[model samples]
Target: MYGFTIVENLQKIDQDIKRQELKYHQKRVMVSKEFSFDAAHHLHCYEGKCKNLHGHTYKVIFGISGFVDDIGLVIDFGEIKKIWKEQIEIHLDHRYLNDTLPNMNTTAENMVVWIYEKMEESLESDQKDCRVEFVKLYETPTSFAEARREWMTHE
Candidate 1:
């Protein structure tokens, strides 16, 4: 009876270890970061109020998805923040978005897409563990625009 109990306990321990190993091996996680900038813009074609230069405290949200690597991280938050600051935030902060992206009118929708593209391009070049999943651009606290790739759309 004593021997049988010992065998049963060992089997249970082995199963628990296997379960933990499987959990560690199966990797799916999503991480996100947010940034903000204040920028001015004007629409060239607008005949109304927006034709004049205007500014907004823009807030940006970025979502990244992928398996956490062996180090148990999707990607370093600092790295993402750095990329954002360098690629998007610093350039647009307190400056005219229209002057930077002159080819496209700096509407909220177009800015969102442009941000998404910037994030995608930066992440593709910098981070290998995760991909830029979504981008949201807030023109104001109440108004915002979002853009996602066709592959990333949820149904």
Candidate 2:
């Protein structure tokens, strides 16, 4: 059987580790965050069930990559949430997609790209060294559309 042992002393910042040692590596890293929103919309000029007015609880995932800062952190997860809430989710959560989004089909494919662009733009505006690596938007539990940096930048 395995045994558990209690700690004898807590590691103090200055006593156990120096401030200069806070950052342990210089390698670039990727961090991701997921968010969900519910919105209503209907596709234009399409002969399908989705053409009818409908709604979906959408899920979006963002993968951002960059070199770590002094603390060995790529980007704070809370910063990602703040960016999503203030810059992206404001136009998405509980709103009419057809009205809020730019003129487009409102399909997962289109939305994923738009979401990726928005995140990229936000990061650029903040002058953050990080870049959006990819974005995945799920229209359904089993159906998702993805936008990758290579495809966006190369094309």
Report the lDDT tens digits of candidate 2 across residue range 1-155: 99999999988998998888989988889999999999999998899999999999999999999988887889999999999999999999999999999999999999999999999999998846899999999998999999999999974
Leading candidate by lDDT: 2
Checking candidate 1 for backbone clashes, the offending pairs are: none
List lDDT for all candidates, in order: 0.80, 0.94
Error of 1 at 67 (Å): 1.0
Question: Worst ten-residue run, lDDT, model 1?
Answer: 4-13
lDDT of 1 by residue, 36-144 (tens): 8888889878899889988889899998887866546778899889998888777789887777774898898888887888888898888885777778888889998
Off by over 4 Å in 2: none
